[model samples]
Target chain A: MRGAVMYAPGDVRVEEREDARLVEPTDAVLRLSAACVCGSDLWPYRGIEPVGGATPMGHEYVGVVEQVGGAVKGISPGQFVVGSFFASDNTCEICRSGYQPSCPYSVIMGSIGTQAELVRVPHADGTLVPTPAMPPADMIPGLLAASDVLGTGWFGAVAAEVGPGKAVAVVGDGAVGLLAVLAAKQLGAERIIAMSRHEPRQRLAREFGASDIVTERGNEGVTRVHELTGGFGAHSVVEAVGTQESMMQAIRSARPGGHVGYVGVAHDVSLPGVELFFSHVHLHGGPAPVRRFLPELIDRIWKREIDPGKVFDLELPLDQAAEAYRAMDERRAIKALLTP
Target chain B: MRGAVMYAPGDVRVEEREDARLVEPTDAVLRLSAACVCGSDLWPYRGIEPVGGATPMGHEYVGVVEQVGGAVKGISPGQFVVGSFFASDNTCEICRSGYQPSCPYSVIMGSIGTQAELVRVPHADGTLVPTPAMPPADMIPGLLAASDVLGTGWFGAVAAEVGPGKAVAVVGDGAVGLLAVLAAKQLGAERIIAMSRHEPRQRLAREFGASDIVTERGNEGVTRVHELTGGFGAHSVVEAVGTQESMMQAIRSARPGGHVGYVGVAHDVSLPGVELFFSHVHLHGGPAPVRRFLPELIDRIWKREIDPGKVFDLELPLDQAAEAYRAMDERRAIKALLTP
Candidate 1:
């Protein structure tokens, strides 16, 4: 088997690795059909987040179950499935409340690296959702998107309480942000504003149901949103880029009593309490509970109701993993799809 | 008219002030029945918040309408009313959404100083909710509580999403925190945990329906809450003290995906984004939309179903306002009522 490994910042290589095997009785070994480079991957690739020596890369994946341990009852070998990046037993109080990211018995599948030919998924019965059947070959990218990005964006929208007749503003133009636009649209937001300066991403944003596009950043972007929403800011604002500026922009871009759903993995950001206290906004976000939305997301994708896969602009064979990382890291591609 | 004025930190004086008169067409002049020294007043008194000049102090009041401007249609002279500390038009989009504190035309009643014989209330028709009729003397204290502390505490509980079968933890033992326990009970919480170290406040908390009391602070307090809830923390945590430690404690005391309703006037606090992100908690709070809850709260008080006013541990005449402030500032009283 071959897997992508990050030896240092900006250095990624695909090398022959030992085959993945089920470690726990509740685990399942997956022969990955497709994997992708996530926007979060750029954090370490840019050296902003520490790259521990020889780290296994990738968490987003879609694959067919190759083998299952004795205790895996719901998932079986040969079934095509999409699993959340965070594995959870799904029966805990946290998981039942739809916060699998912090589930007491949760496991991070990222530690096992999904950008490989085979990977072990823990708590298979709870973390993986099977497709109705073998998804058509062309549907792989979209299902793979459901593994992380699509579900993440969906969570952002849901956290913002996006609903019919809402005016939504999305910060950041990365794949997650773009998909949030799609999620807001699906959630019935009446007006969608995508904040982006990139023309290509702007076009894609519009295609994904953005009613308007504001190229400004920070305060200027907030002002644009207010102007577009009759000076009340947006009813719901999604923060997909985890930064002080983006978070503040999202907060300022909402109407008093509006919601700011931030899904960005906050880095060196510290929110001033006084401002948040007086902003009169509802704030909720974190690493998304992707597993909670996987079944619905898969159903939507299976019915061709949404095309989240369009976020992928570059596709490569698994062996060219280095090129895939570079393209995404350099912003040359919104997302890079890798086929194992 | 005599009103409480803060000339400097720890320097409060009851001085003869100009007569209160209607200003805006929506204004109403009220002959204050009662006013109170709030926990927030101690902020400036303690010199933690700046006292730029001789500022009039106090916002909580239940009064009889002495006069009303021509445009005041909903409220009239001779009506005994319970008004929110924040005057809101209550017709704006934000107000209709139940966030009167951030209404575009909202006015802070504290600036005019309700701790006086008379005061002018703006947006009277919207800010003041009349009691069913003139209440008996015993109900005066409770109705006055509804003016601010009760409403603020209720907002905290509501923001924390307190409801049946939920575990609620209140972080501040102040008047507002005590009343939040009352609010959580009214909202049907199955278990109410009041976090307090004071013996008197703990007794008051129990009277207000606190099922348990934890006397620890900071991390130890969080651990105690976890121990109380099978290590999952409280489902709803109300934060009533505005400080870094209290805010962090409230957040830490809630389970993942739990609610933290904070109502303290934040002085200086900064939340680490990374910690909040990983905490997986939902945060919503601000100045209490007291006007939004005034009607329901007043009704409960009128029916004698709740005794929120039990939080008032001291009462003084209008001229003894300085003593009232001193007692509350010194933590000798949970709250002080001033009869003007």
Candidate 2:
């Protein structure tokens, strides 16, 4: 099997790797149909996060189950499925309560990188959601989006309590943020303000239901959000960028009693407790329980109600995996889909 | 009028002050019936927070409406009332959203000092909630508790989303935390765990509906909480101590997808964003929009359904205001009542 691996910062390669095999009866071997580089992958690629030595890359994936373990009850071979980045036995208390990432039996799926031709998924029945029927080829990317980004963005919107009549503000221009805008719109938000400096991202943000755009950054951006929200701030704000500046902006851009749903993985960030206390906003977000939303998202994608696949502006063959990483790192592409 | 003033840290005095008078059409003068020392006041008194020169102290009070400015409606002179520490117009969007402390027309009543014979309250019509009838002398302390501590504790419980079948943990033994235990019980929490080491406070917590007690602090305390909740954590946690240790304990004590409602005035706290992000708990708190719960709290106090006044362990004449502050500051008293 061919898989992408990163040896060091700015060094990603596609190479032949050992075949993925099942070690547990609850596991399923998948022949991944589609996989993509995630924003978080840039953490190590840009040297911001350490590449622990030839680490396998990619977590988001959608594929057909090539083999299933005896213990897997709900999933079987020949069915296309979407699984969460975190494998959880969905029947656990935490998973039942809709926080699968924190499930005691959960396993981080990134360790079994899906950027390969074959991937082994554990807790198959609880972690994978099968589509009602096999979809057309064009819907593959959208189905893949449901595996992580779309579910994550949907979780962000729900965490922020975006609902009818809410004025939402998104603090990042990444795929997740743009999708969050779409999610807020779908969740019945009355208005959405996307904060993006890039023209291409701004246009996509608008198409994703952003009613307004603010090109400013930092304090100025927060001030613009306040002004746009009648000096009260937005009713809901989604933070997709993990930087300190983005987190503060998200917090400051929400009105008192509003919510700030941050999906960004925080790095070297320390929030001043005084400011957060005085902000009087509800804060909720973390590693999204993507498994919880896979079914609904798959349904929406199957019905063609949403086109999250548009985020993949660049697609490359498995052999061109390095180029895919470069394109996304250099901002030449929003996201890159890989086909084996 | 006479008021309690802190000339410097540990140097409080009872001094003659100007008679309370309305400065705006929205102001009202109240003849305070009672006032009490708060744990937050100890911050400035013990010097963790600055007592910037002769600062008039105290915000909680139960009083009689002495006079109202021309614009005041809904409240009248001679009416006994209970008001939140933060005076708000209550009609603004923020107030309407149940966040009165963040209301644009809000005024910090602490600046005016309710620990006096007479005090001026801004936004009278919106700030003061009249009791059903003049309360008997014995009920004064309970009503006074509702003005701030009771309301704050109730808000903390409500913010933590305490309800039937939820396990609640309170992270302070102060009057507010004890009251939160009561609030959680009233909110139908299945089990209330009060985190306190002091024997008297632990006893009071038990009386207030703490089904269990965890005397350990910091990491060990969190361990005890997990052990108690089937190795998970409490469904709800109320943080009434603003220090880093207590904040972390509250966050760590809550299960994933649980809630943490923090109300203690944060002094020098800084939250590690990454840890908070991984905690995956809903966080909500602040100065607590006490006004939001004032009406129901007052009614409960009036009907004698809850005896919040039990938190006040010491009582003294207004002239001994200095001693009242000292007793609460020294932890010799859970709360101290002052009467003119």
Candidate 3:
């Protein structure tokens, strides 16, 4: 099987790997149909995050179940499925309460990576949401979107309580933040503000439902949000950039009693206490419990109710995985979809 | 009129002052029946919080409405009233959204000093909760409790979602924490754990409804809470102290998806981003919008359903305001009430 691996920072390659097989009672072997580069992957690629030797790369994918362990229930081989970056036993107390990311017996599938010909997923019964059936080729990107980005963006919107008559702000211009703008609009937010300095990203943000755009950074960005919100700030703020500046910007852009849903994969981030105390904004966000929204997202995608797949402006053959990483690393592509 | 003033740290004195009069259309002059010392007062008294010379003190009070401004409606002269430390119009969007403390037109009564014999209350129509006639002399303490501590404790319980079948943990041993114990019990919490090291406070906590007491601090305290909750921590945690240790304890003591309602006036508080992000607890707190709880609290106090005023362990004549401050500052009293 061919899989993408990062030997070190800025070093991505497509190479032959051993076949994947179910290793646990709740495991399932998947034949990857589609996989994509994620914003978080840029961390190590840009030397911002430590990368060990030859680590499996990618965590977002839609695939067909090739094999299932005996203990797996509610899923079987030949089924098309979308799974979150983390495999979770949905029956755990935490998972039952709708926080699957923190599931008691969860495993990070991102480490093993989904950018491959075949991948093994644990907790199959809880993590995989089967599509109604195999869909047309164009639906693949949207279905893959459901595996991570779309669900994550939706979680950010819900976490921020973005809905009817509410004002929402998106703090990142990446694919996830652009999708968050779509999500806030779908959730009925009256005003959706996107913070982006790039013309291409800003154009996509507007297409996705952003009513306003603030190209300013830091304090100036916050000031723009306040000015747009009658000096009270937005009713909800979505944080998709995992940086100290983005976090503060998200918090500062919300009104008192408003909610901040931050889905960014925090890296070397430290929030000062006094600032948050006075901000008086409700803080709730972490690695999103993406599995919690996979089922609904898959349904919406299959029905063509949302076109989140538009985020993937670059596509590559599975064998050209290195180019996919390079394109995303250099910001030439918002997201790069790989066909296996 | 006479009022309590702080010339410097540990220098509270009783001094003659000009009588309070209605200064705005919505203001009302109140003849204070009672005022009390607060834990927050000690911040400036002990110089933990800087203060200028002869600053007026006291924000908690139960009093008689001696005069009403032209715009004041519903509330009449001679009505028994209870109000929070911060006066809010309670009609603005922020107030209507239940964030009265941050109301656009909020006025801090602490600035004017309710410790005076006569006090002017702005936004009187919306700030004062009129009691039924004269509350019995014995009920004065309970009514006084509703002025700030009790209302704040109730807000904390509500913020933490302390209700039937839930486990609650309190992170302070002050009057507000003890009252939170009572509020949790009233709200139907099945288990109330009070974190206290002081013998007297522990006894009072138990009396107020704490089913367990953890004398531990920080990680140890969280471990004790986990041990009590079958290793999952409490469903709700009330933070009555605003220090980093207390905040972290409250956050750590709650299970994922649990809520922390913090009512303590934040002082030198700072939160680490990663810790808060991973804790996954729902965080909400600030100077509690005590006005939000006053109506129901007044009813409960009037009916003698709960005697929250028991938190006040000492009483003194208004002229001895200095001694009352000393008792609380020296830790000889949990709270002290001053009568005019």
Candidate 4:
């Protein structure tokens, strides 16, 4: 089976790999139908996040189950399914609390690499949620998105407490931030503000239910958000860019007693305790428990209620994996979907 | 009027001051019945927090209204009242949202020095909550506690979401943290864990409804909390010590999806953003919106339902304000109440 592998910084190659087989009684082998290059992938590809050696790439997938081990139940072969980046035994106490990413026996599916022809998924019954049926070909992109980004954006909005009458501010123009605007809108936020400097991304943001757009970054952006909300900052802020500046902007953009839902993969960010203490905002985020939102997201996608796949502005054949990485790294594409 | 003034670090003097008079149309002059030395006062008295010059001190007070400005309605002369350290116009949007400390027109009562014979309170009607009746002499300590420590503790518990069946861990054994145990118990937390090494404070914590006491501090304390909670941390953590170590300990002691309510006056603390992002804990706090909880807290004290005043272990005449600060700073007393 062919899969993406990175031997070093900026080195992504698609080559033949050993066949995946059942490793545990609860494991299932999935034949990939769709996969994508994640923004987080750039962390290692850009050498910002260290890569030990030829590391397996990708953690997002939507595929058809090809085989299942003896202990795997509920999920069966031939069913199309969406799974989170983290494989969790959904029956654990943490999973029951809707925090599957912190499941006691959770495993990072990225280490196993999902952007391949075949992959072994541990804890199949708990990690994978089947679509109502084999989704139509047109629904594949959105279904694949539910594997990570859509669920992540949904989690961000929920964490931010985006609800009716809330003025929400999203601090990032990436696919997740754009999708957060959609999520906030779906969750009934009265107003949504998307921060983006690019004309194209701003257009998509507006299309995805953004009621306002602010191009400024950092403190200026927070000022604009405050100006938009009558000197009180936004009621809910979704921070999808995990940088020191972005996190601070999100925190500062929220009104006292507001919420800052941050989903960006933070690196080298340290928040001043006194400022955060006086901010009087609720801060909640992490690698989102995508599995917790998969069921509902899949249902919404199946019903054609939301088209999160719009985030994928570029698509590529699985063989063009290197180009996908290059395009996304250079900011030529918001996200690139790959068909295996 | 005589007020406590800090001429220098470790140099506190009770000196005659200009008479207190209404300064704003919404202001009221109050003759302080009781004022106490706070843990935060030690920061400046011990020279940890810088003192600009001869600064007036103290913010916590339970007093009798002596005069009211024209616009100060509802709170009239002769009314016995309890108010927050921060005086807020409760009618503002921020105050209405239950974050009075961040109210646009909020005023720090410390600037007027509550540790005085008489002091002016701004936004009187909004800041002062009248008791059901004049609290009895025995209840004075408890009512005074409500003016700051008890109210701060209640806010911490509420912010941490300490409710039925939750395990709550309090990170400080100061008056506020001890009161938080009582608040958690009153809020129905099934288990309250107080982190304290001092036997007396630990005893007070247990009396305030602490079900367990952990003598360890920092990471070891966090490990202990996790061990107690079956490898998962506490469901709610109240951080009443605003230092880097205490903040991190509080954050590390909460389970994923748990809440950390911190209310200590932060000095030089800073939180690492990456760890916080991945911690998946909800962080909420500030100078507690004590005014928001004043009415209910007062009512509870009126009914003799809580004995928060027990935290004040020393009593002194207002003239001995210097000794009061010295006693608290030297840890000779948990808290010292001053009678003007």
DockQ of each: 0.92, 0.91, 0.63, 0.87
Number of backbone collisions per candidate, in order? 0, 0, 2, 0
Residue B9, model 1, lDDT: 88
> What CA RMSD would you report for each candidate?
0.7, 0.7, 1.6, 0.8
- Across B1-340, the per-residue lDDT of candidate 1 in tens digits comes to 8998999989999999899998899999999888999999888888998998999989999989999999999998899999998999999888999999888888998888998999999999889999889988889999999989999999999999999999999999999999999999999999999999999999999999999999999999999999999799999999999999999999999999999999988878999999999999999999999888988988888888997879889999988988998888778999999998
Where is model 4 more than 4 Å wrong at Cα?
A: none
Better of 3 and 4 by DockQ: 4
Question: Each prediction's Cα lDDT score?
Answer: 0.94, 0.93, 0.90, 0.93
Off by over 4 Å in 2: none
User: What's the alpha carbon RMSD for model 3?
Assistant: 1.6
Q: Write the per-residue lDDT of candidate 3 for residues B108-212, one digit (tens) a residue.
A: 989999888999999998899999788888889889999899998998999898999999999999999999999999999999999999999999999989999
Interface RMSD of each: 0.6, 0.6, 1.6, 0.8
Q: Rank the candidates by DockQ, best first.
A: 1, 2, 4, 3
Question: Chain B TM-score of model 4, please?
Answer: 0.99
Docking class of 4: high
Clashing pairs in 2: none
Candidate 1 residues A11-108, lDDT tens each?
A: 99999888899789999999999999998988999999998899888999899999999999899999999999999999999999999989999888
Error of 4 at A134 (Å): 0.8
Candidate that would win on lDDT: 1
